[model samples]
Target: MKKIRYVFYMPVWRKGQWKDNFIGYGIAIWTFALNCWKPKMWKYIRKHFFSHVEMWFPDEDGKFITMTPEIDLEPFAINSVPQFTGQCFSSTMRDAQGVRFALASEVLRNPRRWWYIEATVTDTRYELMLLLAKRQEGKPYDKWGLFTGFFMLAPYLQNDDERYCSDVCAWLAWMANILPKRLWIISPRRFAWLLVKNLNRELKPLVKGKYNGKIQKHSRISRCVQIR
Candidate 1:
């Protein structure tokens, strides 16, 4: 299957108001799932942002090099309503007055920033992606990354925000050698159990049932621990 990309930009409303675009929730979700799935999530993100952004390199010898391409955006359409919903009619406000939503061209430049953010989140800091996504569902990568990239770039908080997220965060804090308590690991084993559950969807269930319940079973048949 050829690799594809999708990006969904979900908006956040805090206290019933628009917050940061979709990056807020999308970041957290991607990161959490990646950390849960693979412990080396951060390493992957670090390589992408600081290192040269990669594109397919061509050589008869099968060597690949990275390249940067000029990707532009469609001009912002003014006097236009939101694509999916016209909710902006009421929320669109201007300085000293309530006006329609007509964003300037400079404001549209966030797309490039989004590209960097998405790439960074997916590269190594997948957990941060997950955390960001927890706030809203209509995120950028959630749609764009899915519709275009065909990857789960858009964060899905509902899917990964529960106990498993705590597990991923806790593990990240632990790896950083930060106190686990600050990361809320009073129930490390509890979060671990949830991690195993979410992981079951990706891989196979490392241990069945609840955390404590599966402890003995895991100990007895412990051979290849996938979520360790």
Candidate 2:
């Protein structure tokens, strides 16, 4: 018999829950259920529950902030419509004006669409991963890499300069020695699944209402656990 460890899932909107619960470096995976354009495409193409991923870490002040590779079309397009022309840019999760102080506040606007898993790593590794992610800020989003790696089944086509959502997450895991370098090309859903599997825990939702999406058969979705 083996002992199982659990990774508790809680609502991101709940006040003080983030600071009280997640005190380590973690990764958050978002779903397309919110009617977002990019997420909808990811949901349709990947057919997975999670479409995008982002990394979160506490700043020097101990307030958590999210870092992700997003497609910003403002620089290249006339309208705000997102397209392949949008380059990948590393930035903190922010609003239209690009002001973001903490991850909890941002997710509070739509808590149901997000869930996070704390990575099990040493403090040294966490620092290294954070540094690696910071260096990726302002990098171009890998449009061709997304096409060839996921659609064309040729991950080697991906260049070192630009990266997609999951590519950046996978790269961080690889840099921290948590995952092998060979598994560089990965989908957001696949990466989350791997984390859950590696942690040997099931996702126990803390809030009520349905959150499960089109997950694979092997993926486990436990009943909601009320936090009193």
What shift in Å separates residue 133 of candidate 1 from its native position after superposition?
19
Count of clashing pairs, candidate 2: 1
How well does each candidate superpose onto the true structure, as a TM-score? 0.19, 0.52
lDDT per residue for candidate 2 within 50-147, as digits (tens), equals 44455555444433322223444768533221111111112222231121113333332233445556556777786676667667766666656654
Worst lDDT run of 10 residues, candidate 1, spans 82-91
Candidate 2 deviant stretches above 4 angstroms:
1-48, 59-104, 150-153, 204-228
Query: What is the lDDT of every predicted structure here?
Result: 0.25, 0.44
Which ten contiguous residues of candidate 2 have the minimum total lDDT?
A: 80-89
